[model samples]
Target chain A: MSFLAVEELVARIPDGAFVALPPDYSGCAMAAVRGLLWRPARGLRLLGVPQLGLQADLLIGAGCVAEIETAALSLGEHGLAPAFGRAWEEGAIAVRESTCPAIHAGLQAAEKGVPFMPLRGVLGSDLLGLRPDWKVIDNPFAEKDPILLVPAIRPDVALFHAPLADRAGNVWIGVRRELLTMAHAARRCLVTVEAVTEEDLLADDRTAAGTIPALYVEAVAEAPGGGWPVGLQGAYPADDAWLARYAREARTEAGFTAMLAEFVAR
Target chain B: MTREEVLLLIAEVARLLEGCRHVAVGALSPIPAAGALLARELADGAMRVSILGSRRHSPFTDGGRELFDCAAQGRIDAFFLSGVQIDGAGNVNLLGLRREGRPIRRFAGNFGAPYLAFLVPRLILFRTDHDPRSLVERVDFVTAPGSGPPGVWRRGGPVALLTPCCRFAFRDGRFLLESLHPGHDLEEIRARTGFAFALAGEPAVTPPPPEDWRARILGPVREALAEVYPAFAAGLGG
Candidate 1:
């Protein structure tokens, strides 16, 4: 397994890459996201595995993202994600509105190598009216029953940060199995971790059950505190003061840029 | 909002979700989380509460998809949703407001509403802002509809809509005013409401929140709430 430098790994992701990112609570490859920003790329597409937060907001604000598909974009208790809110209000980015289960179902279809997945509900929703690709067909198995079928979403890359990675390149994500599904559905997965273990993760059964084998992982890089500001489940807590300050200042474009300057400058 | 007001809302939510076996609350929903916890407390720990973001409160070990799968299997009985715009017909718009078919204002997009609103038997819709603007005659977009076309698959929908002014029960595709909170009158509700609703008889004032709230709310409830919502718990006062 080749463990490249973090930015070197990020350099392989071309411009306009359709990247899938985990939700805020889940691990986020913030270091790689910042690495993408430094490359001066544009028109990158983002897929929020159901939802997103500061990572998506900052990317959108930095003018790297051209389109976003997600169930919701929010900062949890911190408040509305200001940059995405501004872009949404201005119609600067094309928004593909979706629901939580629908995104999961779509990805599951891809994970299974299926073309589409049938989902419950959304028969009369106005959201369905806008999404022409989302089709409603009679349930072949049941009489007079209708269901919605969403096409599979196969992203160009799945990027995230985790607590641990082993010498064999297996990443231990513990009970957050959604990350596993994401790696299965995406073309390739790129990961950054707080540390790299010397021992084989798969050598132990306890860690093996929770590990994503290197077969699914495209590359690995060790970037300690890579998921900062956003917490890595079971590893750290969110920096509340910094997030609150972001919520307060990121309301204005000038404030967002100022914060961005202070961030990369670190 | 005052602590008493929040407790009042919690009491109302608990009343609505009295006997549900399992209730799943969305992330950042302090009031609903508290209410579900209170209901469990009232049930003598016979019930289960799943607050999405909190590991201590959640039963999901399989990650985010398990919650949806659990709801689809007819397990989750109660859930909560708040919309930027809610119509008389029980359609919720968490997405931005549309003007002339163009989105002008955006709120947080619809999270899990489209599916959960159908599967969860008791869907509680609440809005802290109860003005005519928030409560509309028709939502610009139907993120989640209370009623659907004939043969459209739907298991359940809005049981009741809670607002600062009053509580309205959903029946036959429209909200019918159920009761008003103390210090709020029917006239205020009527003036503030954007849509017409049915009234069966003289509206009754809801029972006041217990004065001994600190005993229940500030004790175990606050401890559990603090675990998920530390700042909110820290801000809670008698």
Candidate 2:
């Protein structure tokens, strides 16, 4: 039911497909994904809080993707929590998202093939201007502040990395469990893991075994240092010297190409 | 001697700020912005200091420039933040609490703090509050890394924790009292903290203020910031 190798896993993606990724800093999926999309023919659409790590950086670095939709949030938690702020400092291209749940909620709506979903609890905020295309409907059932509307985002593919994922595509997001929302919402999901163990999905620690159910997964593969240059906690932190070197080198086209060449050459 | 003395005392610590090419300041963030501006000034145009969502190259798009971007692409060299809850290992949690049956109201956070912890070379802890809740035995969440033990920072982890009462440094997995804020003694400082610490060989005096600190650091930054941000000048308490 799933691919065993990175090459095979990559092959499953069609050239024109739209891919979504989580922006969490806990895993190496972002780097592995970069390896997959170098010289990519597919149109990529990223969905995540602007605060998550390296999502905007990798997307802008690729510089080949079609369109980007973004929402903005607070500075501490949703905005600067992952590592996007650092990426921006080094000259990575990025767009801001207006609301925290809008991106994920939109993706979920798209996955369901719905035009839009009416969500509650967002009114009198700047999010209204950011998502002009979304329809706003009033919640007649409520006696309180009753306006509610949410956008749909059906990404063609969702790719992420987890601490441990089984061969059947059962994902085990470790500490943060940020992927639970993405995993539940995406149309097609691909996951990479540190390793696949033979233990039954139920036996895996529940608090640690996040976003399970073998049926929702399309593929699972193993890739170490997959996060590469970017650090993975419980595995390794970002190689600061290497990252600092990347910051210095990634500011120009020639520098970025040289860095890519090194990765590809390896 | 006065709040001005306190501000100058804190400003003197600006000497420690370094290694930034681009930096940002968030709304209601005084300490980090002040330190970053000071660091930039010391660099004499060699580095860049910015706010979140500026048109810079970032992994997360430039929307609302949040503090977490300090570790994006692992480029940030230092970060200064406060914690509502912190553990022995140095994890931070600023989220307040959930009321009875109200679920949990959340605050705006820049998502990359944890990434900063793992990636940034130095994380300078700053807190205006020096109470037991602020200096807990363990933090509720691992928002940033101070992973191993209290003294682990000396072995290649976080660098310092600055508070209103005193300054602390991580050495050999132990927190050592580096200095006391002017006019404050260790006994008074100790009464407010929740964790244990060692006294430095001699209680060092806090750094004296540089006469040029306000003009050199705060002045140029206000001018540069006023270009894109007229309202921000007011936020700076200028």
Q: Specify the highest-DockQ model's number.
A: 1
Per-residue lDDT tens digits of candidate 1, residues B148-226? 7679777799999988668899999999999998888989999999989999898878776675544677778889999
* Strongest candidate by TM-score: 1
Worst 10 residues of 1 chain B by lDDT: B208-217
Q: Residue-wise lDDT of candidate 2 within A1-266, one digit each (tens)?
A: 57567766766666656666554444547544665656454455555533334444444555544444544222222233122333334434334333444564565566477777654323422234435676655456654334436667666676776667655567776543435545556777777777787766656466334545667677887876666655565666556565555555755667766765665555
Candidate 1 docking DockQ: 0.80
lDDT of 1 by residue, A144-262 (tens): 99999999999999999989999888999998888998999999899999999999999989999999999999999999989888878888889889999998999999999987776
TM-score of chain B of each: 0.96, 0.74
Each model's TM-score, in the order given? 0.97, 0.49
* Clash count, one per candidate: 0, 59
DockQ for the candidate 2 complex? 0.04
What candidate 2 gets wrong by more than 4 Å, as runs, is A49-52, A72-96, A107-127, A143-148, A204-211, B1-238
TM-score of predicted structure 2: 0.49
Fnat for each model: 0.80, 0.05
Q: Residue A116 lDDT in model 2?
A: 71
